[model samples]
Target: MTVTVRDLRPEVPADVERFARSRHLAIPYVLWTPEAIVHRTTRTHPDAHYRSLVAEEDGETIGTAQVGIAHDSGEPGQGYLNIYVQPDRTRRGAGDLLVRAAEEHLTALGATKLFSWVLDEPGNRAFAERHGYRASRSAHFLRLDLANGALPPLQDLPPGVELRRAADFADDPRPMFELDAETTSDEPSDVGADLTDYEAWIEESWKHPLLDLDLTSVAVVDGRPVAFSAAYTDRATRYSTAMTGTARAHRGRGLAKLAKNDSLHRARAAGYKEAFTGNDADNEPMLAINRWFGYEICATEVRHVRELG
Candidate 1:
């Protein structure tokens, strides 16, 4: 069987579906849909040079790669290429072809350092090493059975605080944006980000296909959002917490936990059977919070980096 790699054809529904399917198969912990794939292709910042690559064997698409530059990053020459091959279709050279294609594409765009996420399995780790990538910090993908598992009982709102859905910010989401910016800036990462471009955040994040505003819970204090749990749903039975964070001033109040618990209870009540979230391995506070809500580690992935000459 001849396996070849090619750019995903976003205009074609089947290609987008196939790409999402490959990703869903390779990494079930994360949510992936045709609409999300299309959004990434068409709505991402132009400087990111984002391209989704698919590896096809004969007539079947069996693997996918998301390659892009860190366009918004203040540090230049940073790029990322995450590749996922179908479990049932591996050992067919699809992965190698996709990696080569991804590297070539990113290199052509002037990438000096490239990063990728590899599942923390022996074979996957070996694959990265063979490709010249060195393992970095790892993360865990946690899952909670929203339908069958017990969630923390919601507590009475603190005297000065109120809980609200992200949908309530329809009139002006700038406050939510500011909160997101601050929380994200403090998140642990190999490449830190600054979420300053409001217009770009509106297009790339606020308008994202999976962002479920009604399910996202936020804590407000005197009409200002102080903490939040951003939600993403697949319009099916799955839900994920894209982020849960408290503003700097609200850090010691346990507001982040409160926001996430409210969001989780709301999600379970809304019939989302499965819930997924991720956290950096060293983020002890968030990890402890997720554990308090009974989330169990389902998988781990190590960030791998390669420096280009």
Candidate 2:
């Protein structure tokens, strides 16, 4: 039972399928697909040097690692590698082998600080600690039943606001992108990213395989996207919220709630049966909003950080 780590062969369909399956099984909160796996590898910036590696035992893939530098980050030396080992194959050396390879790759790319997300379980925490990674802020993965769960009824926008779909910005998504940039710049995260590159944002975000523009709801205030909830779907029954935030000027108006609720209602009507989203534990407002939509805490993943010289 020799465990080895190797770069995923994007050209091979089965390899990507296996990798996505393992990831989905290990962390069902986020959406993952073979197309998504391949799109990321093909479209990521070269500076990031992103790669998806699968840990294999004999002929089966038991663990996955998505390693990359935060090339767009204003601050340098930030890199990330999220490792997910199939729950059924945890005791094996797949995880350790995958992390070892990931560390080596990031080091070669001049990464000085590394980040990872581990399930908030004792064993998972121990594994991260044993590897010299220190605990950091945690987040909750929330789930909602779209098929049978009742969603908040869609309401008319307040006096000056209007509801719109992301598809409405097809001709000029720059505004939405700008809004995303503004909100994301302030988002609580271990690695900060700069979304100044329009072309890159189109290739990596707007055109992402899972991004569902029709289901993404945004609140337009005096013709500008003031708040939005980005939705990603597998083009099937599962949907996820990529982000739900509002511009600083629009924070106290419940616009975030309105946008998210609109998006959820649209998603349910579009035949999506399951929905997932995540929020930092301290984000009480967003947490309360999700709860209002009948979402339950499905799981939690704690961000872990490590300093490497």
Candidate 3:
């Protein structure tokens, strides 16, 4: 059987489901649904040049790749291609075909620098290095057994603080947007991003298919949102914390922890059995918070970069 790489057919339900299924088999830690897949290819900003690719072998999709330029970065020519192949489908040229197709696409888009996330296993790292990629920073994927493991007891808010659900701000989500922008600017990432486009944020984040506003928790102080934990659920048993952050002025007060704990507790009560989150290796505070909540590191992935000619 021969493996071929091609763009995903977003309009086909079976094709979209196969793409999502391939992702689930490759990386079960995060949520992947057909709606989320379509939303990504159809709703992302035009400048990003995002395209989802699939590796087909004998009429079956065995791998998937998300290829695009980092248009939000201040630096031009930065591109990313994250590929995941079904665990049972390796050693069949599917991964190689997907990578080659993704690189060709990004290079055609004038990307001078290419980035990809490689699982930290020896074989995966070897594959990336053999393709001229060098390992850089690393990140850990943490998992919490919300259905069985013990979670930190929820704490009461301080005298001037109160816990609120993100749904409470549905009538006007601009405040949440402002808080997200401020906190996201401080996140540690290789490509610095400026979330200045309010309308884009609403379309990309606020209206995302997986965002669960009812389960999201926010810490409000004097009617102002100071800390928040955004929740994304697959409407099944898996829940992931998309983002958790506290404002600069509210740092060192443990408000972010409070928000996350509340959010996690609510998720558990709502029948979410598994929780997943990611943290940069250099991010100590957030890592500590996850550790405090009984989240254990399940996997690690290293960022690899290749300079394109």
Q: For every model in order, what is the number of clashing pairs?
A: 0, 0, 0
At residue 212, candidate 2 shows an lDDT of 90
lDDT of each: 0.93, 0.92, 0.93
Listed in order, each prediction's TM-score against the native is 0.98, 0.98, 0.98
Q: Could you say which candidate leads in TM-score?
A: 1
Single out the weakest 10-residue window by summed lDDT for candidate 2.
186-195
Regions of model 2 farther than 4 Å from truth: none
Worst 10 residues of 3 by lDDT: 189-198
lDDT of each residue in 1-309, candidate 1, tens digit only: 899999999999988988888899999999999999999899998889999999999879999999999986778999999999999998999999989999999999999999999999999899999999999999999999999999989988889999999999988999999999999998898877889999989999999999999999999999999999999999889999999999999889988889999999999988899999999999898899999999999999999999998
Q: What is the lDDT of residue 242 in candidate 2?
A: 96
Better-scoring candidate (TM-score), 1 or 3: 1
lDDT of 3 by residue, 159-263 (tens): 899999999999899999999988988888877677888898899999999999999999999999999999999999999999999999999999999999999
What does candidate 2 score on TM?
0.98
Off by over 4 Å in 3: none
User: Candidates 1 and 2: which is better by TM-score?
Assistant: 1
Full ranking by lDDT? 1, 3, 2
In candidate 2, list every pair of residues with a backbone clash.
none
Candidate 1 pairs with clashing backbones: none
Model 2: per-residue Cα lDDT over 148-171, one tens digit each: 998988877799899999999999
